[model samples]
Target: MWHGDRNGHGEGGGRGSAQGWCALALLHGKIEAHLERELQGAHGLSVREYSLLDVLSRQNSGEGGHLRMGEVAEAVVLSQSATTRLVTRLEDRGLLSRYLCATDRRGIYTDVTRAGLELLERARPTNDAALSEALDAAEGRPELASLVAVVRAL
Candidate 1:
């Protein structure tokens, strides 16, 4: 538990949750940067675009099976407007499609197009490989080794 010390440090022997949070943030940044470089170079897609495609591709066509813009935003960790813009960009690239919900005309659902699925399939390996490479590199660091192990366990 965090002691909530004045310097944001823990009072116990440990550095506390703040330090853990920083470590997690650092690991995330490293992994994201590695994935971004690999995905962008090999697939001509940004990390966000690839993530959007991956998220949308998992939706079912059955009743209430698709994600709304708000849900997509939550999944992608983006704002609602930002998710809409990302959807528009992918739609323009023929990677995604948006349509009105059958039961609720006011609701719009987004799905991955064939092109998006193909691209996602192609990029999946790259993303996985880059993530492994990042974790491997981070594992060598004393500060990140435990986090890397936790991630691998997960």
Candidate 2:
């Protein structure tokens, strides 16, 4: 199991030491790295880039699919400036469109284009398969699956 070893020093080690957190972080990092490569090779998109697309795809504004620049950053776990850069790249590719907020002039929204939605749909199988493979590697242990459940809930 991930929390700690069978000896009870598992999750974080006895009394919740940093080792457990480190272990968790390590597992997360490894899986993310693997998924990053898988997504990139198959779809020409990084995990983070695809994540931005996924977030926009879920938003709605009829044909617009708009989200505030800041909201986009939060949903994608990026700084606003970084989100802007990514959004610009998507804009260049016709995968997304950005516009000023109608009611609030200062608020800029980014929307997923039809092409972006299509790409995200195509990439989902690769994303899911890689994630499943990563989790399946932990299948013999229930604790790891529990952790996955917790993450999915979040």
Candidate 3:
């Protein structure tokens, strides 16, 4: 059996290590699925879309506040091509817009539109609630309780 270590690292990079990784993946997947279902049902937004919107909404016109496409990809944990497609999808829905950077003509920055911001504002609570519910449920599971505790501690 794969018992977790006190430090949450599992035992010395052995079977416990693999089990720890699997447990972490399970925790993440469950939480993401819960968030997805809630966000989609309540706000017509996928987890990725909501995350992108949330990331973009934090941008400011002040220097270095606006993120380039690459930076956005990093922030949202998507590949550059995937991020571009996501941006395009949001743009089609009038949720986001892109413009060339004033300081660097070769650079492009994306911004969440008013519609996107409004939707994000509404979906934020749903996201938070779903995350909380998922973590609470996971905390009840032996395999996931430690991971959930770690996440909560973080």
lDDT for every model? 0.92, 0.81, 0.94
Better of 2 and 3 by TM-score: 3
| Model 2 global lDDT (CA atoms, 0 to 1) | 0.81
Candidates in order, TM-scores: namely 0.91, 0.78, 0.91
lDDT per residue (tens digit) for residues 30-124 in model 2: 67888899999999998889999998888877655567788889998999999889989888999998888887899787778889989999999
Query: What is the lDDT, from 0 to 100, of the residue 27 in candidate 3?
Result: 91
Cα shift from native, residue 7, model 1 (Å):
4.9
lDDT of 3 by residue, 68-103 (tens): 999999999999999999999999999999999887
Compose the digit string of candidate 1's lDDT tens values, residues 28-126. 999999999999999999889989998898889887679999999999999999999999999999999889988889999988988989999999999
Residue 32 lDDT (model 1)? 95
Alpha carbon deviation, residue 136, candidate 3 (Å): 0.4
Number of clashes in every candidate structure? Answer: 0, 6, 0
Error of 2 at 62 (Å): 7.7
| TM value for model 1 | 0.91
Segments of candidate 1 deviating more than 4 angstroms: 1-15
